[model samples]
Target chain A: MLLPWEYGVRNLARRPLRTMLTLAALSTVILLVFVVVGFIRGLEKSLSISGDRDVVLVYSVNSEENIENSAIAARTPALLAASVEGTQQRFGVTHVSPEMYLGTRVNTDENNGGLGLVRGVTTGAPLVRRSVKLIDGKWPSSGEVIVGQLAAAKLGYDKQDLAIGKQVVFENKTWEIVGQFAAGGAACESEIWCNLADLQTATKRQDLTVVALLLEPGSSTAEIELFCKERTDLELRALGETDYYQSLQQHYKPVRILAWLVVLLVSGAGVFAGLNMMYGAVAGRVREIATLQAIGYRRRAILLSIVQEGVLLAAAASLIAGAIALVLMNGLAIRFTMGAFTLRIDSVAVLFGCGIGLLLGVLGALPPAIKALRAKVAVSLKAV
Target chain B: MKTIANLSLVTAIVVLIGCKPSESKNENTKSSEPTGKQYLVASEPDDSTPVGEARKGAKDGDAVTLVGHIGGSTKPFVEGIAAFTIVDPKVAYCPPEEGCPTPWDYCCTQNEVKENIATVKIVNERGKTVSEDARQLLGVKELSLVVVQGTAKRDEQGNLSVMAQKVYVKQ
Candidate 1:
């Protein structure tokens, strides 16, 4: 007689200790996969969400967006506005914000300080980079500054460090903290923003570092290229905001690949550990299997029963691991050289975890199951 | 044993939680103040053209003289090098009535700040930073009017810059 599905389900409970060890190992592997994949996805999401596809970023020729190395003439923005075609205008004003980007030290206390990226921005800043939204206080002016929600934490500060009405020193000037902003988990959340001229004077860099432009709808990249060619005086190179971040994402490809390698190696260990547990279980259940076969259950039926138990254990463990990852890893701040991005453990990540768990159960049970079925019925029944 | 499984679970959880993210480890140790020393200052700068006009028509290799007030920083060249930004006096600054916080520059709430500025770097015959020549214009306070005479050169990248030969500042 064919054994009922309940028989397979109850078999895992027979060896509680071995089953728990195997489940624990598999669950750990699922957690590892979740973290690795989540990290890469988080970085990509942060960059993509932060930049608008319709905008273009113009930097000095042969330079990155870094302010220390790239020196642009102050007149370039007006020159580009008059020269470049397809630039969007808002309320009779051209949508152009010439900005300065720099990484400088920010004082956490009277005696201690840490590195922070500061953006020198004008009134058009909010229009150009629309992702930034002031959440706590007013926009910064003159000697006042606003910090991103993640900036304080990245600078080794606690919650109270960037509270409004506080003071922190930068550029050798005492800047009163006036506001805090959120950028929807964008990289801008790891920076400080202040008045354009204040930062320029403070850094002794009077020139604008880069010009960000909002292009009119239906504008093409050729327009930007033609603008750069016609105005040789500007000495500028234009990149779509999306392209700029795509290149940044490419820069971190190696790190993401390394994370996958780690997942593979760690999961390999889990698979082998699982295989060992199944081997022991099948050996101890050899007589039980022969008795089932003698009662007219086929070898295929016995094999299916063994594999089902392995998969069921993995599924149960996967649920536990998924819950744990959601609580601890989701929305966790992960800092990098440019800024910090949050780890997101969404439904997609959970589905990936479950898929890997299912694969482990199938592969880990196969060899042991085949070995158990190849045993002769009469000899297997008499063996142990 | 169940204890072994529990121990393994606890270890993995602890390890995952302990791997906290952090900012860049490369710390900036430089002081907040712009670094460098005072250069020489000059009294009674000579005949000059407005900085905005000088920037408009001056061709590459043309000997040009520009008169403008410093707009950005009051600090002397950090390395005693003769390089600074100058702005046209015609540009509007914050009036006392506006209660402007940054009186140093006109960019606080106004538009068109960039159209009035130029960079002046003084270099010797060897085309290197001339600390001696820079001294003649060093320590000149920000917003003080000055005259710079230099050979206008378009850099290989086509950016306009001045290789100043003489820089004079008003007392």
Candidate 2:
């Protein structure tokens, strides 16, 4: 084993040109794999943070952006909540918050104007969504509004300006700034919150737009969906947060899928380059490798040593790429048609990159290692 | 006592017959008057003017039926779509999502049964008459239509952009 590794090291070191080329090819592929995997995982995590595994997003079965568009007859929430006994299995009415939603404009009491989604929430909604944090100020009173942390920044309002007594306006209606809250780092940080009543009055939507339900813990997504399906009158649908994000991930699906395709193509190119480079290295290193085998090193041992070099090169590149992504990509928001979301960088993305690199290293090293091991000792010695 | 009951029944029948006009619930049952045939053609969006001159053409200061989304259609159709359909049923939100109408680039609504070209009317789950709020907040009333009036238009894609003016419910 030691003999083979010593030979492998000496052989790789002797053919500097070939070894460099192979390492370059392997490292480039490994680095790219690291970045792409991490990006997808990070984004998925950020999106998932906003959804509960059991919460169903009941939207117009017509309205794309407005609740008023496909107004579910206001009757649905209650019926779905209590209509069937089995629907609300353990603790009846675990959580139901009927709401009205609209994407509209809001002016921060600050200088620059801010435009974003103004969500009308009922008092009970906060209970259903416990992630909401009251950072400062009080709960929104009637005709009062609460701004998100980032929302405050967008409005040109400093954190100090988001005081409990500040005033904000929307749709020509003056709403007293009541309180502020943050939902960790999820997407909810970009909304203007007000009482459902005030939103109704301002938007002239006396009709509520959406019904959100947080199911009792421990219920499987299939079971919940089955229950929603059974009720015709209720006309409700349930999706796990992961499934919902995946469905919405359809928006980012192209990027995610394209990243893999890009990686695969690039990796293929790298593999070709590495194969040529490794073949040259194997041919050039015939003497050293043959000497090691002649001195009693097993073919498997030599193979393992060469493979280790490839793996180490790839892993190093992955670590470097993952670090770069963490530093540069984190919190960088990508603008979409109606809004923007920042990249969520986490430990998961880094680990994913490492895993990709490890796979690449193993796969990339195999062929060249085998070819070198198969070289006949007598011919290799004679050539050298 | 029996004679009094008999008198009350006769009076009640007479009153019911007299006040039937006030209790008429049907909107599309047709009026008794002679009028031009107004087809409930899918709420058409007309965009002959430039953006500077374009607006959700209101009829004599009244809300126009910008579009309608009927409920439970196998083929998804939002009213006033002359051409083009959203490839993905998601809306890109400008802001991070929060509260009830979490910000999204696009999203689907589950309000009232979409009744394309039907007059916008809101009804409760139990089929009762209630305020739009009681229905909206309670998730009882399905939106019959989403009507927008005098809103701006964006024709970036060369399709006529119609903002919702008033949602109509086909009663």
Candidate 3:
């Protein structure tokens, strides 16, 4: 005799439309969960990965903790050059970059313009940010520009538009896109970089916004804080780059919470649809279920069989959803006011989607299976 | 066997929708030279003190006239307030002869333009933010020269900014 599980599988074959409908619904829900969770994970990773523990940022006091609004005097860098005792030095040059940031509009053509943030960086910038790598062409010089792979996306430029020798117009001047770089999927990949002096002259703001310093292995923020304290003229605050990013992550806690709330709302609707399908399947198969009971199958075995079919359908949907998410959403750059971040569909997101699918299958199947089994065997068998 | 076929069909439909093309062909076009006439045309001449000179340690309550260009290409609107930056031409980090490639900001060069900038807050005689006129100035591009007459005041950081009564954009 065929086993009860095989019988359950056979029942699914008899009602192909019902089975297909249920599976499609479950898969759609699975995809929604994957996307929501993936978005949160990508934003967090983008911010956290941008910082280096050995590096520290110095910004002017009372700038509201916004690097864009902060300004340090022209002589600040020169003052801090030799004052900080434990600063890391490479090739006899101090490992410090006095950087500038500008929020602006970049346009490849009149129809393709968008908001972009550009960074004016020194030669030591790459040293301070070890994760950044020049993937093509050469480092920017003078009016030349080098864009990050994702930053180009935010500016409405595609892979070909950002190719070397292309020109993007901004601030009434043409900047040649000479190179492209990436900083390990960090937020820095949302900005274009050029020689520091060139950007300052363009915006006419000669003051450096912030200075990043690489610290010696044994050194800590205390040493740098002390140096800032001793100088009365340079009232600056020093924070580890990692700690700074952590604080920013905290600031965006509300946004992440909002994302989770959306996931719950959308997933709740999916669950209700799934429950309806399970109930309909059990009611339609009442006679089949009673026949199994009359033929010496235990009530518990009948319930298990019903549940097995639901679980199998859900599992199949989850697998397909995970595969689609991985191929489509992974590494897709999403833009916000601050910058752009790449979506990551890693194992965690995939597992989360599958887990929800399994939970829905069990919860949705239990109620209907128990109800179908509660009906009198004589009445169920006689009705057919 | 039929159950397997139905399941495969559902999966195929889901995959197709999820993997649909997101961007259009026209969205990824190449860079072309800037074209067309100026969007904002100036009808009158503007006269005021240079930004570099006005930023000098003027008395906190001193009234002054200032002339400079908006600094960056990004929307310089001060959120709820109606104010923006006015920068002296000489203060731009790039030398006038070198000419900056992007005029909205001068971040690509060194830190010599530190004292060559001033914020222009649009205010009425009552000193309240002029929300109406401020909204009208949103179309002004960065690096567009303009003139302002207002009171000079020092901010918490000792930077001088103007509380403007009038602003004249140099088209």
Chain A alone, TM-score for each of the models?
A: 0.93, 0.65, 0.94
Kept native contacts, as fractions per model, are 0.08, 0.00, 0.00
Instruction: List the candidate 3 regions with Cα displacement exceeding 4 Å.
Output: A1-3, B1-171
lDDT of 1 by residue, A1-384 (tens): 456899988889889988888888888888888887788778778878867888888777537444345678888889788877788897899989899888778885643667888888998888888888999899988899998988875676775877899888888878889999999988889898899999889878778878888888887544564355334456566778887788777777668766766766666666677688888999998899899898898888888888898888878877878888899999887777777888888777788777877877876787788888888998999986
The list of candidate 2 runs beyond 4 A from truth reads A1-31, A46-49, A53-59, A63-69, A73-96, A104-115, A141-180, A184-190, A197-204, A213-263, A266-287, A290-299, A322-351, A370-384, B1-171
Error of 3 at B155 (Å): 23
User: Can you give the lDDT of residue B20 in candidate 3?
Assistant: 60
lDDT of 2 by residue, A1-384 (tens): 454345545656676776666666665665566555655665565566877666655655345333335566566666666643223333433466778766666665564465566778876677666678988888888888887755654443465665678777787798887778787755567677888877777777666677776665654444334333333233345445455555666666667666766655565555555555655656666787788788898887777777776666566666666676778766655433323445655676566566766666665677767766777889877774
Backbone N/Cα/C clashes per model: 4, 67, 24
Q: Candidate 3, chain A: TM-score?
A: 0.94
lDDT of 3 by residue, B34-92 (tens): 22112122343344678778766566888887877776322233433356666676665
